[model samples]
Every structure is written in C-alpha cells, then in structure tokens.
Target: MPADDFSLRKIAIPAYGPTLLYGLATGAILPVIALSARGLGATVALAALVITLTGVGSLLTNVPATIVTTRFGEKWALVAASAWCALAMVLAASVPVLWVFAVAVFMVGMAGSVFGLARQSYLTEAVPVYFRARALSTLGGVNRIGVFIGPFAAAGAISLFGTAGAYWVGAAAAVGAGILSLQVPDLAVRSPGAGAAVSAPDAGPAPTVRSILRSHARVFRTIGIGVLLIAAVRATRQAVIPLWGQHIGLDPTATALIYGLSGAIDMLIFYPAGKAMDTWGRRSVAVPCMLIMGLGLGLLPLASEATGLLLAALLIGFGNGIGSGIVMTLGADFSPSPGRPQFLGIWRLLADIGTMAGPGILSGVTAAASLSAGIGATAVLGLLGAVVLWTWVPGRKAAVGSITG
Candidate 1:
C-alpha cells in the first residue's frame, strides 16, 4: 500500500464510526447510573459502590477481552461486544432491584473492555507503523467527541422519558455501533503479508499468555510503570476539577460550563498532538503533557473563583489533550506481532489499575488530610509520571519508521 493511499481519511468511517457510538453509549449511561440506583432504593454509599463496579468490570475483563479478540478477530469481537453491551444496557434500564442493575452495569463495562481492545488491536494491525500514532490518537479523540455529546443526548432522553430513557439511548448507540462494525472491512484478509519484516522465524508452538507476560517483563516494569502513572494523573484530573469547583462554591451550572469548555480545548488538540508525535517523537509530547498537568494541579488549589478555575481546568485539559493517544501508541510500538493482543491486554490492565488508584488516592488523602492535600498528592504523581516517561518511553526514531521491504 502506498503511504499516501493509506491516509486516515481513507479509513475514517470504518476505523472510527463504531468507537464514536461505543463512546456515546458509555457516556450516556455513566451520569445516570447513580441516579438510577438511588431510584431503585439504594443508599448513597451503595449507589457509589454500584458505580465503582463499572471500573471493576473493565479491570477484570482486560486480559480476558484480549483472548476473545485474538480468537474471534477484531470485527467479530467488536460486533459481539456491542451486542453484549446493548443487552446489558437494557437490563440496566429494566431491572427493578439495585443489585441486578449493578450487575448489568458491570456487564456493560466488561463489554466495553472487549470493544476497546478489539478496536485498538485492529488499528495496530491495519495502520502502517508510520501512521500508528495519528491513527490511535484520532481513535481516542473520536471517542472523546462521542463522550462529549453523550450527556446532552442523555439529558434529552431523561426529559422525554425519565431516567430510564438514558439507558435506552445507550442501547440504541450500542446497536448502532454493532451495525457499523459489520461495515469495517477485514483488513487482515486484505494484507496478510504486509508486516513480514517484523515477523520472526516459525517457533515450535504459539506463545501462551503466561509466556508472553514473561517475555515482556522488562517492558511491563519500565514503560508500563509510566503508563500506570499517566492513567493515574488523567483520572485524578477528571475527579478533581468538579470537586474543587464545588469546594470554591461555584454553582453546578457554572462548574459544568467550565468543565465543558475545558473539554472543548481538549478535543481541539488531538490531531496536532498525534502529528507532532509522528514527526517530532512521542517523548516530545508525553513529557510536556505530564509536566503541564502536574503544574496545573499544583496550582489548582489557589483558584477561589470561576475564572481561576476555568484557567486551571483549561491548562489541565491542554496537557491531557496533547497526550491523547500516548498510552495506546506506546502499546502498539512495543507489542510483538505474534502476541500483540496478549501484550496489549497486560498493558491495559496496568492503565486500569492506575485509573482506579487515582480516585482512591484522592479519596484516601482527603479523608486523612484535606482536599487540597489530595490534589497536591496527585500533582506530585503527574510530575513523577513525566519523569518516568522521560526515562523509559523511547523516541520516535526508536519506535517507528516507514517500511522499505
């Protein structure tokens, strides 16, 4: 395939359409889950616990999702995952009991794990090395766009048909995604011999999951640790912005507006960030991303009003935006083709752990000290992440180049 012929535009619809819908489904349901649990007569703490199960489901399913994708191929796995998510959303909407609703939410998360891995794996194989970062960055950005649109869609549904209407919106989105997944061409069949340069001579037997883990232990320990910290800081930003907005007595509407504005800034930068990575190198973006976020968080506690909060939030958003696909791009760069799915599974598991840990760190610190202290702790982690990335993540020269064979 000519480099020019395989541009992002060529694969835009097939590559990004399902991600948009899947992201929409997830975004629509997230805000309403707690409300639905409360409506089902759960206590505040229980409702919170129910919400946590979504992450738990994703965390537990990471490795297993890779197995499904490896066995079924990306297209079929995506289709199946979308169907599973839609069914889970229906159950979430219809369940009378809180536990069943929680289970349904968990199932939604599990399906998400499968869907996410399938798409990432697909992009890794389908795009050439030279275009990998841009492809994955756009994938991340599209998902963000879907998520950004989701809440408004959910609000309309809620107003028209009550809270349950949100779940139906999610179900509709999932079904849409599944239908689109069918349209994504089978890239595997199209170019079976494309990446032979990187392929090894035939080994006696296919590598098992355990052996793959053992083989890549060095990667999992070094660059993988940076991935964990990156995820942690990112999750902390998501949690801190709203909490601090409220802490400074901003109204919910004002806080939401600031948050939305920040997200707008975030969405605008994904492509440029990706292009820079493809050109300058991953380190060029990754290190600066973490640095800016860390600084933003460190300064967040000084914001006592809406304007200050907006500035701080935008800074954080800018930082996050520039590093949009860093994690997935890194995974693709380091993944060995024969066991790529397995490697990415472990990669995602580390990221998920960091995601869960960020919130826990904030909550734990706030409980013991103060909210400012919690934010400060996360700020420190963000800087630490930058340092780790600088230490472990290789430059573009080391990671990718145009194929000449």
Candidate 2:
C-alpha cells in the first residue's frame, strides 16, 4: 500500500482487535492469580511471590521472544503466543496443585512477552511516521479499555463457574485473539522518508541481536535511561494511590471507587495525548506527564481527607493517561528496520526492569523511612524522567533524529 493512502482506521480491526482480546484475557486473570494460588494451598507470602513470576517470566523471555517474532513473523508469533497462553490458562484453571498453577502463570507471562513484542513490532512497521503516535496510543488505549472491562466479565463468569472462572474467560479470550491474529496483513511500509522497512520479508539477513545491542549502546545508555525512569514512575501509580488512601484511613470500598475513578480518567486521554505528540513534539507531552505525575505523588502525603486524595489521584491519573503509549511510540521512533524486533526486545526489557524496580523502590523506602518518604522518592524519579526526556526527545526539527540516528 502507498504510504499516503494508509490511515489508522483502515487496519483498526486487524491491528487492535487481537490486542483487545489479549488484554481482556490478561485483565481477567491478573486480579485472581493470588486467589487461585491461595486456593491451591500457598501461604500469603508464597501467593504473593507467585504473582511476581509473571514479571519474571516476561523478563527472562524478552530477548528470546524477539528471535521467535523474527523467525515466524508478527502474525504467526501473535497466533502462537495466544494459543500458548490459552493452554496456560486452562492449566491454571484445571490444576489443583500449587506448583502447576505457578508454572501456568509463568507460561502466561512468557506468552505475554511474545504477544506484546509482536504487536508492537508489527505496528512499528505498518504505520507511517505522521500517524505513528496516534496508532500506538490508540493501541494502548484499547488495551486499557479491554482491561477495564475484563473484571466485570470475569465476575459474571465466576458466578457461572467458580474461582477458576476467570481463567476460563481468559482462555476463551486468548483463543479469540488467536483467531483475530490470522487477519493481520503483512504490509511493506516506508521508514521515515525514503528508507525501506528493516523487517520486510524479502530483506537480507538482519544483524545478530548482540551486534544490534552493541550498535545501539549509546541509544540505550542515554534515552533508554529516560525510558526506564518513565516506566518506573508509571508503575508506581497503582500502588501509591491505594496505599495512600489506606494510610489516610479510607474504607476499602471508598478506596476502590477512588482508584476506579482515576483509572477512568486515565483511559480518556490517550487520543489527545497522541495528537499532541504528533502535533507539537514528544517533549510537548512527555515532560508535562512526568511533571504532573511527580507533582501528584509529591502531594500524596498531604491528602488527609478523601477529597484531597481524590484530587491528587486525579492529577496522577491525568498525567498517566496522557502518556498511554509514550514508551511504545518512543520505541517505534528509534527502531531500525533489520533489527527492529531485537531492539524492541531490549526496549521492553528495560521497561520491565523499571516496572519491577518501581514497587521495590517504594517498598524499601517505606520500610526504612515512611510511606510519605517512599512516595516522595518515586516522585523524584518522575521529575528525573522529565528532565531526561526533555534533553533527549527531540523537537520537530530534530524529530527524525530523536532515536534513529
């Protein structure tokens, strides 16, 4: 297809339909993983530990996922990963053994890594630069929309089945996602101006993953640092709000309502954020996102009343909402064609590390000092991310060189 003829609406079903199903599968299962582990006779701490296995699985499988995506192509990778995840969900649902359940959870995480990378790599190739941020941001938005609705579906399923009903729902969604993946077309989209896409089927053999990392070391060391900090800040959003709500003595129901409200606000801003990125520049949104989130976190300790907490939470949510696909958009911005999958693998790994570290940082600080201190520390990371992004994420004239150079 000619680049000019392409529009995001043209491929919406093929591009995002599978993602929504996959997200629903994930969302349905995540809320109940701990409950399932507990039912299988895991201790509280062990059940908690089992939850971490998802992140661990994604961390371990990232680079390998790149190899898989490259070897089989994005469409097949998505299909295989969806099928694998469905089986894993079935195992989780049917298994009475704790260890087996843990293994199934880990497999789901591994599948997630592959599924995530494949879709991201595909979108990076299929969309043009002018529409890139909007495409990716919408991708993020739809995933969030799926997740937002997943728990309600899980609740209905649980009423019909049992505690494992969520797993069954996830399994069904995964199968649906796999079916949808078969419809994604293989497009040969242009790079920035005149270059061919790196991952085109007819292209020559790409560089080894190690060599690609070696070549992109500076990119990783510099802007990659900013990416990590951004992920870390983003990760803390869920934890900080509820923890602070509890600290201030709000009841569980009220706390949940507040959290849901924030999430609702967070879901509403993806398109406007993407439009801002395409119109003004990445920094136009990136810096303000971090700044607002940082300010919100910094203000958390002062929120003694529910109203105060709600306001602070809304601020943080708005900040996060505007940054829905900033990470993926940035990854797409800098990726090289021949090694795009590998580079994105490394990109996702950095993000995963940040995601894990965010909570750890908060916990360590809270344990040693106070909840207020831990939140303050995370707020600092957000500000640091803002500064780093302002320095590295180029404006319009330099946009073409933002990451590719």
Candidate 3:
C-alpha cells in the first residue's frame, strides 16, 4: 500500500501475466491470419473482415461480460473467459472453412471482452489508489512486451510450420494463459466500513443488463467518445501502414520491425509516464499526449525511408504510451461502483466500437483520397479530441491531492 511499493516488476507481473499471454496470442496471429485469409482465396476486403468481425464481437459482448463478472467474481470470470478464448483459438486453427474461422475469431473477441473487463476491474480494486497510475503503466508495459514478441514468434512459426501452425501456437498459448488464470486470487470489491478481510457481497437479484447500462450512461458516453478517437488513430495506422510500407518497398519483415520497435519504445516510456501521472495528474499527461499522438500520425505520411518511418513510430509510441496509463487510471478513478468489472465492461465496449469502425473508415478514406488524406483526417480528429479532453476533463490542479483520500 506504500506509495513506493508500486514498482513495475512488483505489481505488473502478477496482474499482467495472463494478459501478457493473451496479448501474445492475439498479436502473433493477427498478421498471419490476414495474410492466410487472402491466400486461401479470400479477397482483400474479406481478409480485413476477419479483424473487423473480431472487434464487432468484442463490442457486442463487452457489457454482457461485465454483468457476468459483477454477478460472479472477477477471478471466476477471468478463468471462464480465458477458457473460452482458448477454445476459440483451437477452433480457428482447426477449422478449414473461411466462415468457420470468422466465427472462431468472433468468439475469441467475445472471450477477450470478458477477460479484459475482469482483469482491469481486478487491478482497480487490488491496487492502492495512490499507485493506480503505476499499476496501469505496468500493465501497459507488459501488454506491449507481448506485442513486441508475438509478431516475431508468429513470423517464425509461419516460416517453420505455416500459417495454420502459427495459429496452433496461438491456441497453445491461450490455453496456457487459461491455466495460469486459475492461480490468480479473486480481488474483493472495496466497500466503505468494510475491512480488507471482508469477502465480496453474495450475489443477489441481479440488475437487468439494460438497467446497468442506464445507470452508467454518463461514464459510458464519455468513455465511448474518447475510445472512438483512440480507435480512429489506431485504425488509420493499421489500415494504411501496410500499404504505405509496400509503397515504400519495405518487406513484411521490415513492416513487423517497425511495429516491434515502436512497441519497444512504448515499453521503455510506459512506467515513467505512469509515475508522472500519479505525481502530476492524469489530465496533465493525457491532454498533451493525445495532441502529440495526432502530430505523430500526421507525420507518418511524410516518412519515405526506414529512418523516417522509425522516427514516426517512436513519436507515436511515446505519445500512446503516455496516454494509455492515463485512460486506464481515469477509468478506475471514475467508476460508479466498487464493482469495477461492470464499469470496465462499459468502458471497453466503447473502445471495441471505435476499433471496429476505425480500420473500415480509414480504408474507405484512403480509397477515396489517399493514405496521406486518411492519416491527416485521423490526426485532425485526434487533435480535436485532445482539445475537448483538456476543456472537459478535470485538470491536475483540481485533482492533485484527491488520491490521498
């Protein structure tokens, strides 16, 4: 509970181990799946649909998953989610038909929604308020580590065993993560007047899912807007970067390296940024970071070579690293209940929606105009969002000592 006790290695490893594995599997298989879908007689748009469908599934299940966790417990929900994800991965690897694979991906997304909501909610409750930023940073760092490693591993797997083989590896990893989830202790929701020794309240007449949505309307709306902006930024890059890389004569490996290098930079800065958030306040970091992200996105179209691309990657990585912790910390700070899983579900739903829409929208824009135009539009949107955040969100000066309570 001490302020200094929230070091990255100390808090992050335990909370993020299962998540790391999940991310590893997700990141590793993404490129391989897209390429394979195309190779397997699917069109370019159909190949992309695999990714979009997954996000759609996540958006659909986010709220339901949260309700399930609130009714059950975070630990149980996580275990179930992990198991489901593992099963989905197995189906993805084994199924030969494209539609079947799409279904599997969708199920994986649903499982991801549950797992993400539960894991985030658990961290919010388990970590001390003063250390929230550090904890979130640690989580982000580990998640990025998985991203850094997953692609290379997947690429290697593809070379050795082929695309299906890569998916098999992903399946194994998911199952391993599910096994690990069983070991994590269930975090209790903190309640006023209750000592740390108290157990969670027994499940009662559960609120209808609709009631839960209505209850958290304001929080959901704010989170939805922010997540949409973030998603747009990410989507633009995901959709355009590959084409841009091809345009610049970079191979797939080089493309992967760009993302990996960016992830590495992200890992390096995440912890420090988290610490700064706790000390300096969330808004102080988030607003500027968002604008910086916009700048980085805008610069990407101008990059002509490896070095230029790398520089763009670094700027984007650092900017995103700063904002990621702030958003997670804010979610925890503003949750309407100690039942953090429910709130996380709503929060994640918004994010999933943005992610689902981002790639498609960016792709359309690029088709209509150019990659530069798409990236420019995303950058402008990011800048607008940053301005709104600065004006609307509570500032550091107002919340400076608020965590001390």
Candidate 4:
C-alpha cells in the first residue's frame, strides 16, 4: 500500500498497449459506420439505430460475459473476447446492407463488452492496490490517444477508400489486440473472503445470475445512478455540439477540429487527474470535477463563438478526466468478486444505460423546447450527481486519515 509500491512504468505500459489499440480501432470505425449507413440511403433515424443496436448488444451480454470470466479466468476470457471481436469486425466490414451492418455492429459490441470487462478486471487484480487509481488513469489517458487518433484515421480512410475500407482497418487492429491479449499474464484467483472457500478451478460453482445480481445490489445501484447522471450530461454535449456548430454555420472541418481538440485535451489531462486520485482520494477529486463539468454544460448555450466553445471544451475535458478516473477506481475498490470481468460488466452495464439514454433525452428535449432547455437539463443532472457524491460518498480526508493513522 506504500506509494513507492505502485510502479507506474511497470504496470502501465503492458496493460495500455492492447487497450489503446482497441480504443483506436473502435473509435475510428464507429463514426464511419454511421456515415456509411447514411451514405447507403438509410434515414437519419435508422442511421442512429446503429448506435442503439450496438448498445443493446452490450447491455445484454455484459453481465454474462463477466460471469464467464469468473469461471474460465480473465486471461482466457480476454483472449477469446478479443478474437471474437476481431471476427465480428471483419464480418461487419463485408456486410453490404444497413440492417446486416447493424447486426454485425451488435455482435462487435457484445464481444467488445466482454473484452473490455476482462481487461479492466485484469488491471485491478494485477496492479497493486495503492497504485490502482493512477493505473486506471494511465490506462484512460493512453486509451484516449486512440480516441484522439481513430476518428482522424477513419476520416482519412473514408476520403480514400470509403467506410468499408475504414472497417477493414478496424478489423486488422482488432486482430492485433487479440494477439496482445495472448501476452497478458495469468494471476492466481483468491477466495472472496475467510468464510467463503475458493471455488475449484474446474468444478467451482459458476456465479449464478441471481447471486451476482443480489451481491452487487448496493454498489451497482449507487454507481449505476451516478453513472447514468454523468452519462446523460456527457451525451448531451456530444449530441448537441455538431448541430450547434452547423446551425452557427461552422464548416464540417471546423466541427471535426473542435471534437479532436477536446479529445486531445482530455488525453493530456487524464493522467495527472489519475495521479491526483491516488494522492488525494476518490471523493476529493470526483465531486468537484463533476461540479466543474456542470459549469461547462451550463455554459454551452453561451458558446456561440469559437473562444467560448474552446473554453467549454477545456472545462469538460478536465472534468471528465477526473470523473472517469475516480469512477473506475471506485468500481475496483467496491467489487465483491475477484473475477474482475463480472464486476466491470456490472459497472459498465449501468454506465452504458446512461450513455444510451443521454442522446435520446437531449434530442427529445431540444426538439420540444429550446437548446438552452436541453443544456439546462444536463447542467441540473450534473449538479445532482455532484450532490450525491458529496452527501453519500466518504471524503478523501477520512479515507486517508484512516489509512495513515
């Protein structure tokens, strides 16, 4: 638990490589898939359904995939999941029809959820507890590099070879990730606690869906609610920015630049925020960060000019950098099972719900009322999330003093 015991260099590099590659490939391809659907003559609503279908797949498979890791182990689960994802991407690349592409994307989402859950769980188990927060942050930062690059890559590919070509490249990256998954070292599984005997590797009772659900009730409920609120706010920004930019007569390239700039800022800030979490504690960072994010969301309606937009992006990037790091660290801290995949699945499932709902709510509200109303709604939700943390979660001072004294 000593500060020196957490080796950033030792833990981060190996874990980050595959995750970065995976993020890059997925981020690059997703927009292209949406655009491809649009180009193929799909209606706007149908094009949006691609994202919804992917989310549905992830929601359905996430928990089950986590349980699979509990039974088979994280290493193997990751390897299989990555391979399946690679295959799914390849199949998706070949599909000519929009509906078939949607199905393919759904498969990719299911496989991705499994792979991501296993990898995140592996990090929680492999890294030292004291270093876990920073490690998660480092992972997030590294992964953001992929987010930073992927869309640009996809854009370039779309210009040259079209959306299908972009997907082919994504498929290749996924295969590479699968190969990287094979390199992850297997860690020994420990019993949940003193009273519980470690299950036999072969004959151990697989965690029934019922038990996993019951065991994670409180932690999942709290984190799930928090994540939904956070996701709604974040998703509103994502859904609104492009429309706002276009309404204001910004060129497509300028709009793209804004997104890229925000991503770059997020990548830069995520690591420091992660380290701060390690030193300062989760609540110390998370509550204030969410409040800052709320301020940014509230300010978005005022961002008619480039300068205001850039400032809003900075606030959002830094706030999300801190908020995401804390959430991942907390999920690891609260997980009841050593089988990390299942715990991550539980965490992501709840988080994804918010992500899934955010755009719908934002778009609906914006359609019914003014853009200010939509932005105001997000600001209110962010404030509520911050209040929940301040009131319910323990503070950093208490956490540190307990450990130190």
lDDT of 2 by residue, 117-216 (tens): 9999888888877788888899999999988888988998898888799999999999999999999996554333322232233355666679778877
Per-candidate clashes, comma-separated: 0, 2, 0, 0
- What is the C-alpha lDDT profile of model 1 across 127-237, one tens digit per residue? 876777888899999999999888888998899989999999999999999999998778644231332224343455675678778877887888889999999999989
Number of the candidate with higher lDDT, 1 or 4:
1
Q: Could you tell which candidate, 2 or 3, scores higher by TM-score? A: 2
Q: Which RMSD does model 1 reach against the true structure? A: 2.7
Q: What is the C-alpha lDDT of each candidate?
A: 0.87, 0.88, 0.71, 0.70
lDDT of 3 by residue, 311-388 (tens): 887788788777766666766766634445665676676666677666666667878998788777878877976876
Query: How do the predictions measure up, each by TM-score?
Result: 0.95, 0.96, 0.87, 0.89
RMSD values, in order shown = 2.7, 2.1, 4.0, 4.2
Deviation in Å, model 3, residue 230 alpha carbon: 2.1
lDDT of 4 at 212: 52
Whole-structure CA lDDT of model 2: 0.88
The alpha-carbon lDDT assigned to residue 10 of candidate 4 equals 64
> Local error of candidate 4 at 359, Å?
1.4
Looking at candidate 2, the ten consecutive residues that score lowest on lDDT are 192-201
